[model samples]
Target: MLYTNITSINHFFITGFPGLSLEHYGIVSCLLLVLFLAIVFGNMFLLVFVKCESSLHRPTYLIFCHLALTDLTFGTVTLPKIISKYWFDDSIISFYGCFAQMYFIHLIGAAHSFILMVMALDRSIAIYAPLRYTVLFTNTSASVLCVISWLLPTSWMVGVVLDALSLPYCNSNIIVQCYCDHIAITSLGCENVRDVHIVAFGLAMFSLLVPLGFIIISYFIIIVAVMRISSAQSRIKTLSTCTPQLLITFLYYMPRCFVYLANNVGFTFSVPVRIVVVMLYSLLPAAVNPIIYCFKTKAIKDSLKRKFLVRKVNIRTKT
Candidate 1:
């Protein structure tokens, strides 16, 4: 997959959590396997519940369903390869495969940011101006936003991936990451890749901060609106609806911002520590999203109760 005359590395060795002890490998592998299953089933339950329960057909739930789908895709893209690396001792990934993995990871990262932003906006409008919320966050509008989240990244991210892919990689092919990532792959470039790094950092900031800015502003306004409610119970009830999304937003953005800033500012950390931080932010949020949704939203909880409890009762009565 060499696009130029220069000698490009054809394969890379993915170091799964650098500095990991050989004895601890089995423990880490088991944890990752459990995480993958959690992500798969948790999100699948959210998807199916949202689809089957007619009462959960509001725009907010629709957007939440899409977010669950995104999390499923995110886990699939970055988790299995690393799980295989630890469990089966398979670490070699082809150049194009590595490139493709890096591309989708960033693409999904960007899309996840926007989807969270949309979720924030949906809540902000609902709380800030209750009368206008339905008009603004219609089913059609939410669908459109979800489509844009997936499509918008496709255009700019191609250049990001191709830029790194075009660079001449030196002899070393060991990427100090669980899977192929832009920073890990670009650092192997033989020539000065400072400019490419700059472009990537800039895009990364835009993708993360722009949506984050909107989210922050939205929540600020929501706070103001919540405070104005005279009844203490009403205020609590209103803010509670938003707590799940706020928690998810924190999980996704805080570590990302901290890591990117730390790298640029020369704040040093061990390779294992950094990769753990990356995994926590990227994968942990997706795994936790379903739990948050099921527990926080009354609609989802009620739906779960109705489906499972009724089934149990029906089985007992038939027996």
Candidate 2:
């Protein structure tokens, strides 16, 4: 699967959460199993609910549906391999598999970042200009944005994956991190990769930070508009819609920014700690997104309640 003659290492060995002992693998695997199941099923529930409930067909929920699908794909790309690594002691990944995983990992990361920005934009428009929000965030428009969100990241990562693949890998093929991340893979290059690292860092910043900046700006404008509302109740009601988004955004971005800072800025942290930080940002949001939407959005809550009540009534009638 070597696309180039430069790749001497034909495979990679991923050490899941370095510094943990043998016995700890079982515990860690069990925890990750729970997380993987939660991420998969939680996002699936969101997808099904969004699809089944016609009332939840607005731009906000549509964007969330897209987000749910992205989270599911993201977790699928990164988690199951690690779960296998810990559960079955399977750590070797083919070189092409490594490249493929790295590509999707970053691709999905970039996609979700853009999707969050889209969500923020949807919120800002809905609140700041409710009259035109419908016109602005129509289903067609949101679908187009969703397509762009998915494509842009794949396009961005094409060069990245090519660059990494072209690099000579005569050095050790051991990826110290949990998965075949760009940083973890590139660090094993046989030659000096200063320029490559520079480009990689630039791409990473563009993927994660640019959308993050947009989200921050969108929230800032949203806050100002919310404040201008004269009634306390009005302001509270308007602001409450944004609280869940802000919380989820924080949950998603803060750990990512921390990881970037720790990696590039020379902030000292143990390997296990860094891996934990990565997992926290990547998986936690996927697991919590459904809960956030269900609790925060009344429509989803009422729909779930109605379904439960109907099921109860059906059971009682049968009995």
Candidate 3:
């Protein structure tokens, strides 16, 4: 039954990809397994690399460290249940568990947006206020920003959690999506949710769009500053440093905004298509973030290369 009663609806069945048949389960499961492993290993490698290499303890790299940690925790909080749904055929989640998942998902997501905004500020300070950058964004300030990043998200999403909890979910227990999300869960409320929808969506957009706007403005200033540099080589060097951040920011925001629009605005898409878009935005960044940094940032690439070379020499010596 979709919903038996407020108390009775204790568990939810997660039917992933309504479009896929039983035959597609193996392929989908294998793919998700690969992505999960990559997200875990890639983010872990970046975190350890930053920690062991004291040279990367600068303000910007410290922010990168935070981003890496968020990505790791994001996947940890979200992916296992998704993987289990496919691999072990475990699709049921308890009521409290569902609310908890919803909270963490938004928590991580909101924190991520704020972290990216911080990164953009870091880049801007580096470019626009090069001399004052160090003094401005000292190790202490960076740590504070990191703390605020998590705290702000936690505070913001508390309302979302309360909103979900306040609603008596006696209408439907079936969440069409793969995981517990605010929209999907609240939709099952027995009462009319137009006000709830407005408030919930308003909070969601405020959290997402506000940071996004700051990022855009920061990048705009950074771009103008970059263009003012006279030397071609200097401009190239400055832009190269920003490429990884730019790519990751694009990966994070564009698809998310698109998904939001498709759902809210008049844009129409089939259920499976909508789910694919959502999953792409949801999963792609966690997988691509570390890869983008490894490719774009010389420090990260060089660090990994040095690690590999040292490992190779150690193996030879042992042999």
Candidate 4:
């Protein structure tokens, strides 16, 4: 039964792809499911590889582990809801449930962004001050920074969620996209959402743009420093370490920027276009992270082989 508050909006109208056929939804469902699996399995391998390999117990890998965890959490927060919408004929999320979804989405999203910034700083220190990298990004320091990264975004999300919920919602409650995105939800509010938009935009810029700017600056310095190194091998090695981070930064930032720009400018792109953009923003990073990092690092490859091959051999012997 749909819950209704007499004074508030009784039901939300979700404005999904009106012209999208069942065949299209099926294709999208299969692709999304595959992507979700890849994200989960890939991130799982990363976490396991880090845990099993004692040699990988450096501050850099520690931060990488946290980043993978964030990606996994972020993927889990949205992908299930998306899959549900695609698989079920009638999918509806309760008000509180939608709020919770948005909260976690922002929390993990912010954590992921902050971790990327931390990773940039880590790389910069490693490149520019190799001697101090250990002392600076120590285990204690990494722990503190990781905790702060998780907490800071969570705090910001709580404030945003509270403020958003306070606004009166009229008959328009249905979210346009699969999940409860802040921008989509804000558009449904009956009350003036100018203040909400301002606050949300401020938070988004702080979390996304500011860190992105720092990453760009850090990479610029790192690149220049790499060029100064005379040895070809050293230059290649330095660039390799930063490459994975750079790829992730681009994957995350570009789509996010597009989404924010589209929302702010009130661009009336088709629902399918917006859906594709949102899916790419949400899924691609998760799908790419493990593949990029694991393939780049021989150590991770060896760990995966050992973990898988050893288990296979043991199973054969048991059989």
**Candidate 4: clashing pairs of residues:** 12-173, 12-174, 13-174
* Alpha-carbon local distance difference test for all models: 0.89, 0.87, 0.85, 0.81
Q: Please provide, for model 1 over 1-319, each residue's C-alpha lDDT reduced to its tens digit, 9 standing for 90 to 100.
A: 1223447667888988877888888899999999999999999999998988899989889888888988999899998999888888898899899999999999999998999999998999999999987887899999899889889988999999989977888657888899898999999888899999999989988999999999999999999999999999999999999888888888888888888789779997787887888898889888999999999887888888898999999999999
Q: Model 4 over residues 145-170: C-alpha lDDT tens digits?
A: 88788999888789999999898875
Candidate 1 ranges with C-alpha deviation above 4 Å: 1-6, 261-266
Candidate 3 vs candidate 4: the lDDT winner is 3
Off by over 4 Å in 2: 1-7, 262-266
TM-score of 2: 0.94
Give TM per candidate.
Answer: 0.94, 0.94, 0.94, 0.89
The superposed Cα distance between candidate 3 and the true structure at residue 124, in angstroms, equals: 0.4
* lDDT, candidate 3, 71-137, per-residue tens: 8887887778878988888989998999899999888888888899999998999899999988888
The number of the candidate with the highest lDDT is: 1
lDDT head-to-head 2 vs 4, winner = 2
Return the lDDT, model 4, position 232.
99
In candidate 2, which residue pairs get closer than 3 Å at backbone N, Cα or C atoms, i.e. clash? none
